[model samples]
Target: MKNVTVVGLGKIGLPLAAIFANCGHFHVYGADINKLVVDQVNQGISHVNNEPGLDELVAKAHQKKSLEATINTAEAVSKSDIVVVIVPVLTRENGQINYQYIDSAVEEIAKGIKMGTLVTFETTLPAGDTRNRFGKTIEKISGLTMGKDFFLSYSPERVYSNRIIKDLSSYPKVVSGYNKRSLELATDFYKKGLNCEILQVSTLESAEFTKVAECVYRDVNIALANELAIYANNLDINIMEVIKAANSEPYSNIHLPGVGVGGHCIPVYPYFFINNGMHEGLTTLSRKINDSMAEYAVELIEEIIGSLKDKTILILGLSFRGNVKEPTKSSTLLLIEALKERETTVCVDDPLFNPDEISKYGVIPFSNQLADQIDAIILQAYHDEYQKIDFSVFENCSLILDGRNVLNQREIENLGMKYLGIGIK
Candidate 1:
């Protein structure tokens, strides 16, 4: 059996390692700096919450003695025939690419890399970064020639958080490499390990650009929907109805509008394309339009009930997406800041986060006791728990703003509360 080391065993990396281990042809080593994460994985437990089927996969791999977790990345690489780097590449607030974590991972991999070892990167990167930035770094540190003494490949991770296991088997994997041999090795490895179809690209740059293009397309489409939603509001038309009617044509497709775009991929990946020295003006504009949506939501609330100062508003979900525990770049954060600027009191209620976690953002945690004091409620995320929530407890609530456009408007209005949705009259 081939030994495979997966670096940075976080959300995507841990599931990937478990999948590889259970494939019967590979024994996997998961490497991460977090000792708690390492210990949890070693005990056959998943640290990541809300991912379906990951817990069972990790447990089965552990029972078979095919998967192990460690903090020693170099030692894991020394024993492996293949290394897959899935570390994060973050974008700063100023739109600059932060390579600190991935650079450190490359440096560790270089220390123990041997000849003929296949090294692939699954992290999303700027186009040409797989060959120019990381490949050069490995060569400089290990004194090995890429595509000759060692193999280098790029295949972006294309799975969502909650459904990663399903997405791995469902979507066609994109693979590319520095040379012909590198491409062949990567294609063979993914086909056997992932049991998925492979779409091979000519070069590493093409594969890297493909992931960023997917993210940019979503950002731009959502921006268009947001812009149109505002226009429909002024015309006294419902934007949801407009989208449904317009999408009946076979040639037209439109995305939904929200308070703002959030989460790790959609909000951050656009900057990777913008700052790549490509002078992409439309991408930059779309980012600004999406970023301004949280403030726009604040304006909508004010138009319904004049003066937010000294009023208490409750936000439904802290997570960026529904039913997920992750809060990275969530739009509710922007909403809180805007409300704070207006001297309004913000209370947050998320079934995924406890009171201590909610208090970290400097907002009151909503409870049934505080329900009578709430003046307004904003449904930022439509978690399943909120679907059947009893709205009668909030006797003082004057308005319920459906940021996701998922709430029942007539039911809320019948409960003696005002119902407002994005672009809905």
Candidate 2:
């Protein structure tokens, strides 16, 4: 509670570190392998963008002298009372969750960890990993018993990017510890430190599954939405209108349709449970349905524009979730590849990312060209600035394909522009 070290200063980790520092209750040290990110945080400049209120919070944290960023993870761990791990986990080619970075973090922490310190894993993890994998790794490396020599807990990060700070503070936090001592320590720390309600579970495995369950439920729900969107297309119906009305029933709540499922947790966390979750069929099906959405968007474009040969398509967004710069699993990447395979010209416009970044991905960067006779505009992400853009002034495009369903069909049609929106007729 006095000194906090948050490893991995990425999207969620950076915000979490800032929040801890914002309270001014602890001196927080952020550790990351990226030297640039570390430098930026030390200078009070935010490395992540599109997150409202983060810049101000970071500035305030710096001004208070309560937050510091460093590339040395061992140093951060040695000087802190609480060590929090928030690294990325990915699937290998063999279909196993890659815990390489997580293991490395534990090893580093063991090297410099102090006795009686509280260690928490905030990353999404596979079931039984806390007890079978990470706990033993730390014990063996540090030559200290888990519950006796030090403390351990699994408290998964349940928030996404766009509203992460608010979600982190508002959502109920699921916390589980290896032992009673560890449990009470974690409960007290989060309860006093964060603004969220804490839910303490009996075991570390249970807490790991809690986060996985939340993400998988949304994946299944969104898969239902994506599947229905496709069915609505076949029937010439507006899926968005149907969803809005269907949601009027108190018991029914369907997720909104989009280009595809993106972000760090939604598209990736399901795999953590897939290998262990009892009911795997529905989970696999959901993954299949969500993964194909990008291709489906491309199909709609091909149908509208006929031949895409030498056609220039102006893409509106790049980030996975709208209004954010991070695109861990953004469907925009898939859409870009599909269009390029068909010889379609791709022009991307994302205020979050510059033209140089866009060009690095092998696509024509957005230059606000919307100039005469471009093929079509693909509204991939519905950023705030994209809302202010006027489509009526452009005449070159054959039609507008709204991937995220943010555009008004009537308004665009009235402007003499042909409009095609996701799940909209």
Per TM-score, the best of the predicted structures is 1
CA lDDT of each prediction against the hidden true structure:
0.93, 0.85
Where is model 1 more than 4 Å wrong at Cα?
278-280
Give me the overall lDDT of model 2.
0.85
lDDT of 2 at 114: 82
For model 2, the stretches where C-alpha displacement exceeds 4 angstroms are 92-95, 277-280
lDDT of 1 by residue, 236-301 (tens): 899999999999998878899888989889999988888877556888888988889889988988
| Pairs in clash, predicted candidate 1 | none
lDDT (10s digit) by residue, model 2, range 356-412:
988887888766455565678888878889888888656777688888888887888
Output the worst ten-in-a-row residue range by lDDT, candidate 2.
366-375
Worst 10 residues of 1 by lDDT: 273-282
